[model samples]
Target: MDKAPDEAKEVYSHHGVIVKKLEKYNERESACSSSTFISFVSSGTLSVLEHNNDRWLLWVPEERNLSVESDPTEWEVVNTEKPKPPSINDEKLESRKIWINVKDLKSLQLRRNTNKMFFDLKDGTTFDVVFQHGDAQQFISSFRSFVILERSRRSRQKFYVKGCVNRELSKSFAELDLFGEQGNLVARFMKDLHDRPFETTLTAFSKLTGVVASGLSNTLRPDDEMVSQPSLQGDEYEVIPSTLDHPAMSLPPRPTIKRGDPLSVEEWMRHVQEDGSVIKVDTLLMTIFRGGIDPVLRYDVWKYLLNYIPYNCSQTEAAELRKKKIQEYQTLCQQWRSITPEQEDRFSLFKDRKSLISKDVNRTDRTIDYFAGDDNPNLESLNNILMSYMMYNFDLGYVQGMSDLLSPILMLMDNEHDAFWCFVGFMEKVMGNFMLEQTSMKEQLLQLACLLQILDPVLANYLNSHESGNLFFCFRWLLVLFKREFTNDDIMVIWEVLWTDLPCRNFHLLLCIAILETEREEIMANENGLSDILAHVNSLSMNIDREAILSKAEAMYMQLLSNAEQLPIMACVTLGLPVPPDPETGDHEEHLKLSNMTPSDDDEDAFEKAMSHTFL
Candidate 1:
């Protein structure tokens, strides 16, 4: 009981704990001539050394086991094995485990239990190990292992395993008393037990009592992101721009921030953390594209080009282009296959059959296709097209929509590099949308509005009158590069036309304007609300006949491009971000309100003083 607070001057101390073998339980013959080296058959019952020096280990061959409990979850019963003694050597110190750090996990096969006297101790009536604090004299100032005569007796103590009965062992590890300056470390440990894995070698201690090592793995960093379900998976991040025009148009002009107070890191972190499926998909696609492509494709080059586009293409024509690309991709795989099956052509293999971030994905061979009838070229060729293109652009590592783009391309050209070049060509204009910086998305949306207004000002007025101006709901469509808007097959057609740069860069924006035009009159006739109008536009995603949409979209592209100077200059350049304004709102008032809160502390203090009455 005197060993309560681990850091009190009277109780804090450190002791190296280990299980020492008292006597041999099941004896067997030795194999290796070394005095400490021992080997036994599959079944081996061995005694555990209850006490050992500061650092300890066991030795065994890779095939042999250090035999913990047979059933890991129920570690209470140690099934007796026919133990054999190994030729013991005083020591020939060589171990792979100690070289690599595994300070916390209880069960591992590091292959050192051969000569060492360490074995499973399933006698699980649990308790802790406490040591008393003492000065160097080992007497005047005391803190050391002090056990009352009643607990362990003169020799041994018998134990039985059962359900938890919180029998307090006053002399337990958690209840330690200590004294002095290192109190903070002890306090931190007690406050956050999970952090123990990072600091202590308590893994072996828990294993000695058959306790599960569940609480031993945790990070102590204060600002780490907390997840509902922790993953064993590691973390990686890569950002690339988006390519491909969407039905939605760009945003209008943005208001300035006006040299005011900027948001703090915490504010920014908080703002971006409330993510959506778009974000989730963003992370997934980027991860796959990163690995699925050549590893060298990482961070190649960044370009912000706006390639001009033309108009007048049909959806039927787009579909034909997709079929062509898929055929081209298949032919590329055939060429690579002819080189060798040595798997050396790093440029053209599926890094793995599984999707990135999938829990079931094996850590082993990621490139082999498991689902396509053992090993099919379809998935392989698809990976080829992806990796090839990822290598080609390098600027856009691969956005989520790129996969959608690639899949349809694979169906069309099928030859890796050729399909890749087409995707790269298509992205030259639309890629800005995928930039982390929202340039393309907002600009397209704004331009879409201008196009719509130019064509049918009545609907544009209806939208303006109802406060439904910016049309932000089309965000997903633009961000995903229209991947979500069209059916799997139809996306191929739309993308092919987009790739041709025909109907020019603003064609996609015109597509949206066309959609709004068809639905605009209906929207203007009803004064119920703008929600329905927005919903109506978004609903046109897959339902809009591709041929009609493309036809109208092309016509609108011509109408705007032909009247080039009249087109709205790209919106949002004023604010320096790609986000649009609420069609009817302005940020000037908000900026002014924020301005009042930015007085310096010194000025604030002086102002307070001046406000106080002199008489007071």
Candidate 2:
């Protein structure tokens, strides 16, 4: 006969009990009652379910036989708003919630004698959960390990190395030159422990803690050699064999760009076709890949990159198209400016948009010479163009960062009509970033998360472990394509190259990866939390070396190509590149390219030529 399942074992068990406070007053009990019982949740079972990519859920059921671990659609959800203020006494001033986030939990303590568990939350509220004696011990033991592991994960960000000594291991591991290896293992161990709540995780956490605590206790002089060793008797300081070999914890080499590398007008001239038309998209892309266009040539080159003038359009044809586009822009502007207050009142959205546009135009790039000074005509010009854009695309309206994207284009173009049209063309590439409901931003961030997971799983895991896997830190970077991160002149150069759309599509995403690559070591070294990482990235504004970013981004693109077979499908889709061959049939799947498909030359000669030239 088959053995019966163990009734004592917790497998989404029948029910668990929790006590909630009551709101109604009772004269006798309320006279001295510090807390009132609202309802006893005796029909529910507690289960942990993975929520978004970065967080887990501790759900309670309302009725028996409810499968909390099943589809999330079936699970009762909460708004993700901040928890309510703690009550002076545990009173049920509100309706009961079926679940509370594991993230909001600050601590969990158990009173073994009373078989009750107390949950201390980040919002300063406490909840009392009661269970039978046997169930209480098991729940406390399991949940305690989870809390300790989470604390250690978050605490990792605070400790940093000083003078080559690992903060966690102190001088002992440094003397042995085991800091890097041991640190990596512990990170992996922590990651593994947090991924699931099992007996194995508890066992691993116990061992990992002992090892980390032992390492933390050591104090060794700089002169101490490996031979002069000290021991903490009865301490389990040995590394866990399983954690030492995690492949994801190994850090990749940081990207680098050699000095004195900037593309010049002379090299750019070399790639122009004989008819004065731009060369094949590939050749122009190669030219602009680094050392962006010279300032003098930016105005001319930008037209082709922005596709205001087609790749093969002759000078005569461009002049004709320019006149027509000017007329087109004026017509659109006049249509909006002609709108009387009477018509605008009927369409409240239009009025609201105009007000928002006025506020943004007043602030956009006001510090720059082009838009500065009292009643600057250029500022009015900026305002007019944005207001015209509102008329051109009434649906998108105006987002806060659109001004940042348009500022450089206006600076490069000579007239309002030209600037307006150029801004229109530029928006085609990035407008999705400003779309309603943030659908595009979410998609891009998800794509970025996928790329990071492949390139650096350790960093990716750290971000997810800290509930920051959404990659919202990259919002500004993507919103305006790093417009705030560089100066006006530098932005002109960067924008023109990005317009080329060569090597791969969505090259901006690659640029994001490139920037992250340069800072990966420091990020890992500091073990920065989400806030620190966001601050560090935002602080990089105006300090970035554009050429280095381009170089490293190029290098990363090549690396992805080299490892195409192992690349994730979403990455290929994001890059607008074809998916690699299927292992079974050895057949490749074709994808329609979203951006310019022209392949750029990845030769070293251009890099060499750029480095050799000295700008006069």
lDDT of 1 by residue, 27-61 (tens): 22222223322222122211111111111122122
Q: For residue 253, what is the lDDT in candidate 1?
A: 30
Question: Which portions of model 2 miss their true places by more than 4 Å?
Answer: 1-246, 249-276, 525-527, 585-616
In order, candidate lDDTs are 0.34, 0.54
How high a TM-score does candidate 1 get? 0.33
Number of clashes in every candidate structure?
90, 3
lDDT of 1: 0.34
Q: Which pairs, if any, clash in model 2?
A: 21-38, 22-38, 263-291
lDDT computed for candidate 2? 0.54
Q: For residue 516, what is the lDDT in candidate 1?
A: 67
**Tens-digit per-residue lDDT, 1-616, candidate 2:** 1111233222233245543322333332224233443211323455543311112223343432212232221112223243433432323421333445554555555443445555555565555555533555566445432233332223321111001111222121122221121232223322323221221222221122222112211211112222212322222332221111124422345445442334577776776666666666675566676556678877777777776888787667778899999898889888988999999998666776687677778778878888888888888888889888878887666655677788888888867987887788899988776753344554566567656656766776676554345454565688778887788878877787787776788888878877887777766566666556655665677898887888778777776776664454566767776665544555554322211111123542332221121110
Clashes of 1: 90
